[model samples]
Target: MNARLVVVAVGVGLSVAGCNVAGSRLPDPHLSGRDAQYMALVPTADVGAAYERYLVDFKTSEPPGSIVVDTKNKFLYFVEGGGKAIRYGVATGQEAYGWTGRATIGGMQEWPRWIPPKDMLERWPHLQPTADAGGLPGGPDNPLGSRALYLHEGGKDTLYRIHGTNEPDKIGQSVSSGCIRMRDIDAIDLYNRVKLGANVVVI
Candidate 1:
């Protein structure tokens, strides 16, 4: 089935509530190499929605360059204005514990190493690696895939991130530890699109 038809059949409100997308057409995924590998798996998922990256028409008043994350639906929308947007499937942390509200993109890293939070380590010390102080090095197998966007507020770190994941199939779920997880390729694409100080709303 065509991507647009597949989208409605899968029931994503035909284009998100209030999205007001002019049409149902969606562009192809922008990716290659490792990115393509992850994105390819997305279309094959059984989640019933076309969760792969889609350059869809979106209607919003959030301003261009702003990001709106619909955590409940596991979708992230990057408002491109003129009634356009890039939608990416995402996996969020536990509902009750996930980070929500306004934040800004404070920093980003490519192939960022994994840094186990203190509480996480305290709860699962056995997962700790003795290899390095900064945690696991960046790689295709690393959870932080190709990039990371650190979220912050008022110049302080929020400890929540929108980053790539090695687990591409998990993109449309609610099973993360408290971060926004994207396909490695999608993550890289988002990292490139977002700039420091850009506004982000998680609702």
Candidate 2:
């Protein structure tokens, strides 16, 4: 698949910016009891007011329930129909490892295990043992955090994911391998909403 530049719809407006007009973080109703409990144990970083989750008046042609990722803006929009989307801050891939295209949500996992890919192990040989041993288990210290949405194309795994990150400070930055990274809270929220076979467009 080839990457193409997509122009965002014009006249787009934000419906609710950063929890409230004051930009303070608040408990989200989307979070479950388990999600809240997990969050309480993790050390979270502020990703700035601009990157906070919000409900926006999205003017996108994509159908409702589709995910549109604006890598340039470090935002991921979950289309909610009726000109609205739930926008969440995300951490994208670095320049050398960036990927953009369309894929379906082929699989989903809660507290996914992390197997450092072959390339990643080659880059950092010290991780080879973990990879050989069947990767790291999912937990508070796991890089995959609370949930993962696997992207696939044509019935094949793309090896890229939209997953929760242990490093919340990385949100709003392009510092990942090739996957999209979100805060644990945001990941859980998205994971709960997204279903298998849902469309994901990253650009």
Each candidate's lDDT (Cα)?
A: 0.71, 0.79
lDDT of 1 by residue, 67-167 (tens): 88887778898888887888887888775557667778998897788877765676678757722366887777677677898877778787888988877
What overall lDDT, based on C-alpha atoms, would model 1 receive against the true structure? 0.71
Which residue runs of candidate 1 sit more than 4 Å off their true CA positions?
A: 1-49, 130-132
RMSD (Cα, Å) for all candidates, in order, is 8.7, 4.6
**Candidate 1 TM-score versus the reference:** 0.77
- Spell out the clash pairs found in candidate 1: none
lDDT of 2 at 43: 61
lDDT of 1 at 82: 81
Task: Point to the candidate with the largest lDDT.
Answer: 2
What local lDDT does model 2 show for residue 88? 89
In candidate 1, how many Å is residue 25 off?
7.1
lDDT of 1 at 185: 63
